[model samples]
Target: MAAGTGGRGRRWVTAASPVLLPVASAGLVLTLWWGAVVAFDIPRILLPGPAEVVSELIRLRHRLWEQGLVTLTETVVGFGITTVAGLLLGSAIAASRIVDQATTPWLVAFNAVPKVALAPMLVVWLNLGMQPRIAMVVLVSFFPVVLATSAGLRSTPVELVELARSWDASRWRTFAKVRFPYALPQIFMGLKIAMPLALIGAVVGEFAGGNTGLAFVIRTASAGGNTALAFAAIVVLSLMGIGLFYAVVALERLLLPWVRAVTA
Candidate 1:
C-alpha cells in the first residue's frame, strides 16, 4: 500500500514540476502587463489591455471561428504534403548514396531562396487559393522533415543492421521492421518543428495573396486602422497556432505511445 501511494505521489510530482515554472512565469508576465498598462496610461489603440483583448475576442468569435477554419484547412493540407513528400524523399535519398550526393547541391539551392520571394510566383502559378498557401507551407516545412528523417535513418544501430543481414532479410523488410521504426522519434521531432513553421507559412501566404483566412481579416482591419479588430485577429491566429501545436503533441502521444513511456 505504501509503495503504491508513493509511486502515485511521485508521478504527480514529476508531471507538475515541469508545468509549475512555466505557469508561474506566465502569471508574472501577465501581472507585469496589467501593471504596465495602468502605469503607462497606455491607449487602447496603441496597446489594448488583456481584458480588452479578451472582450474583443468574445465580440469577434464568429468571424474568428470562420477564418480560423480556413487557416486550419491550409495547415492540414500543407502539413500532409510535407510529411508524405519528406518521408518519401528522405527514404529515397537515404537508400541511395549516389542520389543523396547528386541532389545535395540542388536541395541546398532550393532552401537558399527565400520562401517569401517565391510566394508571389506561387500565387501566379497555383493561383490565389489554397494551392499557393499549401505549397508555401510545404516549402517552409519539408526541409526539417527531410533532414531529420535522413539523420534518423543513418542513426540505425549497425548491430541491428548486421543482424537483419544475417537473417537474410529483404531490403524492404529490413527497412519496414528496423529503419522506419528507428526513425519515428526523429520524424516526430521534425513534425514538432514543422507544425509552427507550417502555421506561419500559411498565414504569410494568405497575407501575400489569398482572399480568405485570419490573415485577410488582419490585413483588412489594419488597413482600416481598427486596431482592436486587428489585434483580435492576431490573438485568434496565435491561439490557432497553439491549438495546432498541442494537436501535434496529442498525436505524438497517440501514435507513439512507446515514446511516451520511454520519455516518461
Candidate 2:
C-alpha cells in the first residue's frame, strides 16, 4: 500500500513540476495587472482587472455554459467528419501510387484555400446554421489528417514489407496487419493537430455568421465596448481549446497505450 501511494505521489510531483513555472508566471502577470489598474486607474472599458472578469464569469455562468455547448457540438461534429473522411481518403491514396499522383494536387489546392475567406460563401450556401460551422471545421481539419496518415502509411520500413512478403502475406493483409498499425502514431499526431483546428474553425464560422455561441458573445461584448466581457469570452474559448486538445491526447493515450509506453 505504501509503495502504491509513493508511486502516485511521485507521479503527481512530476506533473506538478512542469506546471509550476506557468502558475508562477500567471501570478506575476496578475499582480502586475492589479497594480497597473490601481496606479493608472485604468478604465474598465480599456482594461478590466482579473477580479472584474471573474465576477462577470460568475454572473454569466449559465449563459456561457449554453453557448459553450453549441460551440462544443460544432467542434465535435466537424472533427468527426474530418476524421472519417481523412482516414478513408488517406487509405485510398496510400493503397495506390496512381491515386496519390492524381489526388495530391487537388488536395494541395484545397488546403491552400484560406478557409476563413470561404466563411461568407459557406454562409451564403448553407445559411447561418450549424452546417456552415461544421463545414468550416472539416475544411480546416481534414488536410492535416490526410497528409499525416498518408505519410505514415507510405513510411513503412522496406524491411518490414519484405518480411511480410516472405510470410506470403497478401497486399491487403500486409496493409491491415503491418502498415496500418505502424501508422497509428502518425494518425494520432494528425488528430492532435486537427482537434484545435476544428475549434478555431467553429469559432471563426460563428464570428462571421452565427447568432449564438461564445463568438457571438464576444462580438456583442466588443460592440458594446464591454472589454471585460469580451476578454472573459476569449478566456473561455482558450480554455475550451486547451481542454479539447487534452481530451484528444487522452484518447490517443488510451487507444495506443503501447505507443505512450514506448515513447515515454
Candidate 3:
C-alpha cells in the first residue's frame, strides 16, 4: 500500500511540475521584490514596487497597448526582412568560398559597430519612420541568421554529399532535399537569437526620437519623472521579448519534428 501510494504521489508531481514550477518561481520573485520595497522604503522615483508598477500599467493600458503594437509591428517587419535576406545570403556564401570571403568581413564589421551609434544614421538614411525601424531590426538580427545558416550548410555530412553525388543529383536537388532541410535547426537557432535583438533594434530606432513605440513611452515617462510608468513600459517590453522568443520556439517545434528525435 505504501509503495503504491508513493508511486501515485510521484505521478502527481510529474503531472503538476510544469504548471507549478513557473508559478512558484514568479511568486518567489514578487515576494522578494515586495519585501525589498517595504524593507528599504524605496521611493517610487528610484524604483517602484510591484503593486505600483502594476497599478501604473493598468492606469495607462490603452497608451501602452497602442505604442506596444507599433513596436511589435516594426519588430515583425524587420525580422521578416532578416529571414528572407539572410537565407539567400547565407546560402550563397555557403555554396561559394569566394562569396564568403568577400562578404564575411563586411558583415562582421557592421556587427562590430555599436547599433546605437548607427541608429541616427539609419534614421537619416531610411527616415524617422517604420523604414528606419525595420532597417535597424534587419541590421541587428541578420548576422546571426546568416552565420548560423552558413555554418549549418557547411556542416552537412560528407557521407550525405557522397550519397547524393552517387545518385547523380543536381546541385539544386541536393540542396532542396538535404541541405536546406537539414539546416533548419541551425536556422531556427539563429531566429530565436534574433528575436530579442529585433526588439532591441526597434527600441533603439524609437530612441532616435520617434513618435510611437515602447521606447518612446519609456523616454517620455522617465522625462516626466513618472518612474512607475517607465517601469510599466519596461514590463510591456519584457513581455514582448518573451512572447516573441517563444513564438520562434513554437515555430521550430511545429516545423522540425526531427529535432525532437535527434535530441531524444
| RMSD vs true structure, all candidates | 2.4, 2.8, 1.9
Candidate 1 Cα deviation (angstroms), residue 45: 2.0
Off by over 4 Å in 3: 1-19
Best first by lDDT, ranked: 3, 2, 1
Candidate 2 has its poorest 10 consecutive residues by lDDT at 255-264
Q: How far off is model 3, as Cα RMSD?
A: 1.9
Best by the lDDT measure:
3
lDDT of 3 by residue, 39-144 (tens): 9998889889999999999998999999999999999999999999999999999999999999999999989999889889888887777998888899899999
Q: Give the clashing pairs for model 1.
A: none
Which candidate, 1 or 3, would have the higher lDDT against the true structure? 3
Clashing pairs in 3: none
Q: TM-score-based ranking, best first? A: 3, 1, 2
Specify the highest-TM-score model's number. 3
TM-score per candidate, chains pooled: 0.90, 0.90, 0.94
Writing each residue's lDDT as its tens digit, candidate 1 over 93-198 gives 8899998998767887898889999889999999879999999999999898888888889899999999998999999999999999988899889988999999
